[model samples]
Target chain A: MANKLVAHMRLPQPISNLLAARNIQTAKDALSIPEFDLMTLLGVDIEDVRDALARISKVASPPYQTALSLLEERLINDASSGRLPTFLKGLDAVLGGGIPFGVLTELVGPSGIGKTQFCLKLSLIAALPMSYGGLDGRVVYIDTESKFSSRRMIEMGRNSFPEIFYSEGMAQEMAGRIIVLHLTSLSEITESLQQMKLRFLQHEVKLLIIDSMAAFVSGDNERSGSMSRDHLLNCPFSFLKSIAEFSCIPIVVTNQVRGHNNDGTSQYSFLGKDTDNNSEKFMNQVPALGIQWAHAVTIRLIFEAHSGQKFIKVAKSPISPPLAFPFTVCSSGIALLSDDGIEMLGQEINVIRSQGFFSIFDAS
Target chain B: MEVSALPISPTNKEKLISAGYTNLASLVIVSPIRLSRELQISVQEASNIIKVTLQCSGAVGLDGRHVVLRGAQTAWEMFSDEQNLKHISTGSEDFDGILGGGIHCGEVTEVGGVPGIGKTQLGIQLGVNVQIPIVYGGLGSKAIYIDTEGSFMPERAYQIAEACIMDTLESFRFHRKGAEDCHERMQPNYFLANILYFRICSYTEQIAVINNLNKIVVEQKDVKIVIIDSISFHFRQDFEDMALRTRVLKELSQTLMKLAKKFTLAVVVMNQVTTKRTDGSFQLTLALGDTWSHSCTNRVILHWDGNDRRAYVEKSPSLPQASASFSVTGKGIRNAISHSKRVRMM
Candidate 1:
């Protein structure tokens, strides 16, 4: 193997003559020789030895796949695959039946607005069999925040599928099918995504979810202080896009929101001072990963919290309008809001406010 | 014992022993460049000596005993052993008492506050305090100060060192005779020499310094304190992509924590503050938000209470929620005056 690897390296004649004289027939043998020994034996400069090692390594590694091959592979796979239903009626309607396969769907929202809950619900939904309104496949839920909870999944599963949950060992078996990887860094996430390509080929994984992509990448642009941040970000996004497209797996990524201002008015104006204007000013809440990241996603869903209720707005979708609706997260998971539920929510807010339940608000 | 016991040639062994490679442990830690230069040997021979010394030191054991996985019993024993734990003092008695002695080694302590509130002062004070000789109530160790915000003042450090030297000399005068003869050892230059300062202008430099810190600490064996004055300075601005920033910050903190644990050093990181609007009002919070709040083992917040500088222990494992009043004077951080004195002056 070492000899074959060295045969691929086209070194200068002088270097080859030195190698032949020293009986170094292989790259491995040459590398195993100390730098000082190599220099002394070859009667060459240290730079020449370094160059030889570099050339050996370059030949040893295989070349990357071409773009034409990637495109051919994508075409060979089914490109017009169907969407995976999110199991929320209003959300499914806004997302045109559900999140589409062979594309990247970004879920952006602020903290405590059920972005994670929605992803968790999707993970369970993807794991369900087709007979019970699911894609009937496994899920790769890459949790960056260490917030992936199997206990919560069990609670949601018990609510969604009582018959399967109450059955002996069924719920545990179903939950086992969904793979959760807790990655703490961007590089680790990139490596895991690369490795998951092989895992996806072996397993029946239909969905790939990175719960809160912003949790890892946030605040790095200033630290790097170079233009390479966009390049560094492009690798994972492009890899995810290619993997989703080639394998026809739906990729759901969650992102955090930062405060944005348009025309001198705060977009997330929950202050109630501009009640009439605030409802129409939903475009100012920018996603965390800048415009470059925004352009990478096929669809962008923005989740917001307003008046003790959660709202999912289609911020930027290729097929849908700027539509939104209220939803509530219960022990059963995210459910669409009803007319009576909205009235009850209003009364609950009034009751809490009148009773001074949030005394910190008053003190502040 | 014979020098021939080493793997080198007889002539080379004599040279190595003459160059102070008499012991295996010392040979294991010495750099190859120093060995080669001192002994006038080839770099290859020096590297071979280092390799042999490392193997003999049980660092890379052939029997795999060096990599044994200990059970919870060993962990519990290590946790309960008080002598094994060491702390670097913050130089102020009140601050040290608030910290339950001082900042313990093998833990990351974050000091956060609004601008001009003495976070850097405390960092410099700790850098100076780390050099206090073990006989004078200190760890007698060096410090690696990685300054991101350029707040590390050498003049201030010299003043603190001078005050510390004076304090040590006064104690020696009371405890022993011929204290004046020890003036050279008590010089501020000696204290300043123990601090390795690295001024990082960008986050990339910060990461590079941190990634190579283990190597630096190993080369400088006495480095027991790592200070990054204002870890959040470069991170708070120009970060259009929050996700990338968070990832970098998380990775950097993890590396710092690993260095702290593996090298048994006190990692002190300084952070800035942002006014977070909660409940229709502004409240001062750490710059990196909730994601980074849990990264540090201990968090101390410096704030102003009238004319005095007050420190609050926002988070700690062994210490309770506590507050102490300390002021950063020209001579460095010191305990504030008593309330009785203030009342009398008023």
Candidate 2:
């Protein structure tokens, strides 16, 4: 007699619920190969293999239909919850106090435009208590360019908590809450962040910060597949969105603007390339998903350097129109300058621009 | 044949359950009006669906964005503990005292100044001093220094090290044997030579340096203090693209914040000043633009006034904003303004 062996796997709770709700004998029976095949054969409803995999991985429900519903509900809940991070105060206020959670907020600008600085400040501010314009949570920072400096953080912390600088313990206390990871590739970013979220489960991390998302995509390497690179860049933001939907964490990403034209001009295009060297040649904006990022993101912050100061403008916000703020860098760090300083910086920059004096534009 | 009733149009009950809304108490938290408006079908429809979801499905409730489960209290406690476990500070009257005790574990603080204004000096001092316990709140740890400008003087470090240790003039001298002894003692007892538990690196190698430094900060259980002397050096040199430099600086700022939080180490960054040419005249400014300004929690602008010294508190998270003058003498940083004020009163 031939030996008969059968493999059985218990269904997840959601799958069991889906099967039982549909009055199926078992989850296996409910999702029987014959039935799934029959549905495809009948052409009554289509089954997306990739989507099915996604459902099986994320949803607990047995029935694909129920899992789809759960996914939709989760997506909508994430969108409406307003957990996405907006890096700047102006950007957040315009975005109804914050960018929608479970999505992405991208700060884009040319070099020296304050994009990275804005990203760092957002990370620090996001971890702060709610009263001080923070969501009071933890943060996972992925640095592709290898630019994190603990000394800078301590110096920044000293401004707020002076004693923290003089005391190692206080520095540690402040430092421990920040989870920083450096990755050579964009792929490592998403995986590291997922693991970090699990490790610090209880800390309601309000933000996922990727300082200069462009670093993962662009560099000296002969990396091709622009779409894939963009998707990879967007991966961590998507993960943060999922966390934000369930745990309410916002994801903030900074992007470095690329100069499309080789012409010796100091002007920049934030999203895309320009066909001509003329300012009117500004074609479109480039981001993780062409215009998709602008649409999917609840807020867009554009940082521009005027004279010696950085001007933050709300390039795009879901709830508010664009506004501008002038910021200055001193020995201690960045500061919202007095109106006089802002005007002065603005005027000084105007003079430079009118003179058409171009500084050597080198991309880092 | 009926396609599972097409999921019942996601009725009021189904909506509540899917939204993680279960009981009336939890429903109220997300805004009763919004819930009521959403469930406008009928009271019976809402109640029946809720009953079906709760009794049959055993789904938890939703209070706005939060999923209301039974173990929420415990989860919240765990979250609070992770968020609030802060390190205390040493009672250093000038620096530590200004910070309400010590450096916090999860924040970014900036120490900014022009090149000669002693940005790295303060950082080096902290690197030597931050060697206590958590209760006393020191990692009893050494430091990892990233020297962008190549100006890190081992002699100066040795001098400070001597003060923190034996406080003898002989020990502070930069002799070959004294330097060797200081270097050996600086390493944790368990660490080996190649392991170089403490060292300094340059600016161009900052990315590689930070990557390695992060590992050291993490693996060492009781290690404390990570310092970057002049974070702006490479950024300043790679200044052709202000935008790219901003990105690098931001990346630096974000990574620093994360390491500080992950390791609970006191991270200190020294910043250099840049000369901005305006109207063909040059005015000194901090490099990296608003990126540095916005990212830092505290900003210390240091300058020289004739023979006196000045260090102004430009920004702080939990401390009052004030300019205080202090002198760095053989004994370390001492408050000059306070003494002068008292002298004037006398």
**Candidate 1 per-residue C-alpha lDDT over A255-287 given as tens digits, one digit per residue, 9 for 90 to 100:** 876544332221111223343243234333545
> On a 0 to 100 scale, what is the lDDT of residue B6 in model 1?
67
Alpha-carbon TM-score of each model against the true structure:
0.41, 0.38
Model 1 residue B329 CA deviation (Å) reads 1.6
Off by over 4 Å in 1: A1-364, B1-75, B177-183, B339-346
Chain A only: TM-score of every candidate?
0.65, 0.60
Please report how far candidate 2 places residue A197 from its true position, in Å: 51
- Model 2 alpha-carbon drift over 4 Å, by segment: A1-364, B1-92, B133-138, B166-204, B275-284, B337-346
Model 1 chain A, TM-score vs. native: 0.65
Candidate 1 structure lDDT: 0.68
Error of 1 at A284 (Å): 32
